[model samples]
Target: MKTQLEELQTQLTKAKQYGTDQETLNKNLLRILKERANAERGIIPKKQHHGYIILCSQQLIKKDNIKYSEAVTAWKTQIQTPYPLNLKSSEIKDQIFKDFVEKNIFIEMEICTDSLDIKTECEVNLQQYLFRANTRTGYWEIELYTTGEITIPLNMQQPKKNATGSCSTFQKDSIKSNVR
Candidate 1:
């Protein structure tokens, strides 16, 4: 199991470096490895799991008449992962705020509560597009002019109007990207 984990780690590194779609498969393999580790440590033993790579490779080699070497080298390349985000939390907030101001994204938030009724409306800037506050669904949404929209749910079915709302915190190491 340790050797398998090492091999999967190597594959994951290669996939990331080569910008291959195999990264997802490598990640899944890593997750399976973690589960196996947990089971070995006397955690709940999950049902046996197997990846379909072996069957797919076999089919490609036999049915498609492809060489084993060809099947092994079939790593579909994709866009490389973006550079890591290393900005501080304050820096991230500043950058996001700058983007909002630059994009001219209008933000409006309201909160009202009574003995029996609680209602909130919130709009945050996302992707320099049209923003909407869905008070009924308790989600702040940003609809792109193109096709889809990005919806961020409010915590506990309520939107908090503050410097930082109910969204996840932007830690220095964990933040992946800025507004872009």
Candidate 2:
């Protein structure tokens, strides 16, 4: 039984690599089982067979989640295109929230600073919840499971505007020109 289980595990791994879809994998597994023993009489023990399937399913789920998270992170990092600050900000925020949802990390609270600097603190019930950011300098703080806290500082230079381009000055100038 142990040898059979090991052989089945090897076959399942190969089947996963070769099969393009779940139906194909299932058909291949069924064919292997039928070849091993006559299905008319009976096959492997139900409990043992189910245990193998369950273990394989768990492994596949973990692999898929990791791949998905990596893809999302990559996509999130490329949001700064097309020369518009407001649009980029919205896109970045949306991507962050989406990734958080996909990884099942609940956001307890979020705070955005007025000066384009964001400071956020979050708590996750599970220890596996890891928060990451592409911009190393983005202002953020994370506290995980009562262990410790992480602070990320952002590099934000103050906006530079010509003194003559001030809104108040523009309005005064417009009024003065109208009076003249």
Q: Which portions of model 1 miss their true places by more than 4 Å?
A: 1-20, 45-180
Computed on alpha carbons, the lDDT of every model, listed in order, comes to 0.28, 0.27
lDDT of 1 by residue, 1-180 (tens): 999999999999987877766666755654565355333322333323211000000000122323344431111101100011232334334433343344322121121112212244423212222223333322233322211122312211221221212223212221122222
TM-score of each: 0.16, 0.16
Q: 22, model 1: CA deviation in Å? A: 2.4
Instruction: Point out the worst 10-residue segment of candidate 2 by lDDT.
Output: 51-60
Q: Which candidate's lDDT is highest?
A: 1
For residues 54-127, could you state the per-residue lDDT of candidate 2 as single tens digits? 00000001223353644211100011111122224443354444433542223221212222223554331223
Instruction: Give the number of the best model, judged by TM-score.
Output: 1
